[model samples]
Target: MYLDDPNRKLLEIDTDTRQGPVIFRWLTLGMEYLIGVILVALIVSVSCNVVGRALFNNSLPWADELARMLFVWLVFIGAAAAFSRYEHIAVDALVRRLPLRIAHMLYLLQHLIITGLMVVMIWGGYQVLSRSSGRSAIMDVPLSFISLSLVLCVIFIAVVSIWRMWVSLNVIRHPEREH
Candidate 1:
């Protein structure tokens, strides 16, 4: 459902339009909330570390370690959430100039690339997770904990890419059947 604007540029698909099955919508919302929570934790950890050093001339090593871990999770989860919302960068100027069918083909190709990369990342993450037997120096948390974030988010991204490919295929097959 596109909102018509007389002055608007042609072929600008509204990415803000959230359309997906209930589970995906839930996952997107949950990931967004997770990102917010992680950000707050990251801020708090860094702030405490700063205050400890500035006010007491002592810094907690755990705070720094926690902050780093939170930052890693934030980045990976944020990426997945952004991908869910179609918030990633794209060269839409060129795609907009093409026929709708051709554009769908391009979208399909893009998603296919993403899916392939995600698969590779998933395998790599698994390898790292399996191989790493070490723990954080200060926190004593398993190093695999950090690598799991990559595996989880990449899995989500891959699923979203597959979903996008399916949508593009449908559009290419039955343009008139689009809602």
Candidate 2:
């Protein structure tokens, strides 16, 4: 049961700064900045590789590996930043119509499921990170470094989900107050 917000286009997610805990705000802001840095690095690496291959007849071997790593980081951190902002798609019409307690109950359940899934992902990512020992063939970068991105993002999402659950509980407790 999910749909894009009506004020938004069919595929768009919210980008506005939401009121949240200080730490969440700080973390989300940091992630957003890091996404920019990773994206710039990815572009530079790919551009260097393309220019070297196209104009010089020689490719930068390390560029390909670096680009791949940066791309993975870009995606994972972007996901975490979006999740923290509550930018993910969801249908809320029914919840809006429901009684406050019932609406919050549904939100609580949704966040519980999200947090549970994130925990499972964290466990799996940790397993993969711990078991892997290989390095990038060209750059010699540890393979586990890339895997850590997923784990870190999942952890951040879980924390945000838990915080959302707390907000839901607050609304459930005080039905008269508009949240």
Candidate 3:
């Protein structure tokens, strides 16, 4: 069934390569593992809170706060991973229908817009991280730690987007080699 689809090859090409510096590759892998750990921690915290509430008539207050922080980390890190993988949700019907050159141009434009947004996010996150003095009630962890996730996620995303944009430019220059 997959063999019959003309667009299957394009999809495969889109996802085929890992494009980035060696450091970026290692960092991405490390983030992936961290994401896994955060998810597991979230699950365990929530489970313990629920079980404790059900059986012992009391819940761990810190558990809820920990789960919330873990979830935020999970989402931001997962978003970075998805951006690196080109796995983010996109409405690409127009790009898919356009001629190859136009599509490539649009793809590059999209990357530029995303990169700009990431830069803005990084700046804003940094401001928040530096200015905020609040701490979590239960754990006493600085709220800046949570905001740092945003800064880190955007930094990762911006780097990956820049790398992909370079690859896109190369594809435009040598369209024949793309396949």
- Sort by lDDT, top down from the best: 2, 1, 3
lDDT per prediction? 0.80, 0.81, 0.77
Best by TM-score: 1
Task: In model 3, state the lDDT of residue 13.
Answer: 19
Q: What is the lDDT of residue 172 in candidate 1?
A: 82
Give the worst 10-residue stretch by lDDT in candidate 2: 5-14
Error of 1 at 3 (Å): 11
Estimate, for each residue in 76-100, the C-alpha lDDT of model 2 and write its tens digit: 9999998876676677777667766
Q: CA lDDT of 47 in candidate 3?
A: 98
Residues 54-98, candidate 3: write the lDDT tens digits.
Answer: 999999999999998999999999998776655677776677677
lDDT of 1 by residue, 1-179 (tens): 64332111222223345557556778888988899899999999999999999999999899999999999999999998888766677556777667767778888898899999999999999999999999999999999999999999999999878877877787789767743
Ranking by TM-score: 1, 2, 3
